[model samples]
Target: MKIFPIPCLEDNYAYLIIDESSGEAAVVDPVEPEKVLKVANDNGVSTVKLVLTTHHHWDHARGNEKMKELVPGVRVLGGSFDNVHGCTDRLEHGDKISLGRDVNILALHTPCHTKGHICYFVTGKEEEDPAVFTGDTLFVAGCGKFFEGTAEQMYQSLCMILRPLPKQTRVYCDHEYTEKNLRFALFVEPENEHIKRKLLWAKHQREANQPTVPSSIEEELYINPFMRVDMPEVQKRVGRSSAVEALMELRRMKDNWTR
Candidate 1:
């Protein structure tokens, strides 16, 4: 199994997950149908399936209708509240969808940034390099804002929904916000050497016009202060005791943060 990162419009990222053995592929949050189609054609892969969206966000669901037009009878899977352009499967928490012989997609209801936000975990594959397509719930150095839910929901989603995943799981977020997020991480945790190193690496990657996603959960746990709101250092910086309170403070800071 291999994942291709397709950057689109501003900062949105669309992923193309291909099963090498069967040549079957699934598009995760296709931002543009033309790009996805071009890549699929160039790679000699067939788009027989698609994982539509985690929510109704325009950037994430915009290309679904057109992609459906290009690939007739493509199965589109998404959360119930997504209202995807060409959705065929209405997935809920704990639902599993088979991708190939042993590859399967496990839906995790991680609603906080949005009421219907869901992340997909690809499992039962070779290489043991499992991946999670977290639309906006989790990022390389940060998480999404609390748009329709509270910090409590965010904490539950991260601690309960996402944190338990394998430490080596590669997180494929739906945006190219690593450089910016790492910058903010540096601001929040100036003494964190891990964040400093990651920021330096991200700076070079962005300078070279490269993607910085597929960050491991272990890396996030180490450097993402938002994910470490329970720690003493983060609590001291945010002046919050509980993880949820610290998260809220961090989010409020990011709301005011600007590049």
Candidate 2:
């Protein structure tokens, strides 16, 4: 399986997951149809079999209809309650979708940024390592705002559902917010060498016009503040004992934080 990260509006990203064996592809959160189609064609993918939407946000699912119009019989999949535009298939937690002979994607219902947001976990015979396409629910060093759910819900979504994944699992989130997120992480843990080193690395990547995504779960465990809510420094910074309280305070701090 091959994953191509297509940059969309501003910092948003739309991924193209291709099955090399059959040259079939699936797009995740295609904000723009033309860009995704162009990438697909460039990579020799003749058919787009599926359009997987992580949420109903315009920047994520706006191009669903246009993509379907272009692909003819492409299936649009989203959370059961998302009511995403152009969604033909309603998926619940643990629902599996096969892309080709080698690639299979499992939908994980992780609602926080939106009421019905879901992340796709891709694993198959062709992949060297598994990957999770965490739309806006999880970022490289930060997380999405609680637009529709509470801090506790976000905690469960990140810590319970995502944290347990293999350390080498690559996280393909939907935005390029790594640098800014690392800045906040530094504030939360000023002495953390991991956060400092990652921030510097992200800066270099941005300077070279490279994408700073596809961060491994191991990297996130070391640098991401949201994932480290239980750490002594993070708990002390937030002045909270419980993970939920720490997460709540951290989210609030991030909202008003500025570099």
lDDT for each candidate structure: 0.84, 0.93
Give the TM-scores of the predictions, in the order they appear: 0.96, 0.98
lDDT of 1 by residue, 129-228 (tens): 8999999889999999898899999999987779889998999999989988999998889988999999999989989999998899899998887889
lDDT string, candidate 2, 83-110, tens digits: 6999999999999999887899999999
TM-score, candidate number 2: 0.98
TM-score of 1: 0.96
Best of the candidates, TM-score: 2
For model 2, the superposed segments whose C-alpha errors exceed 4 Å read none
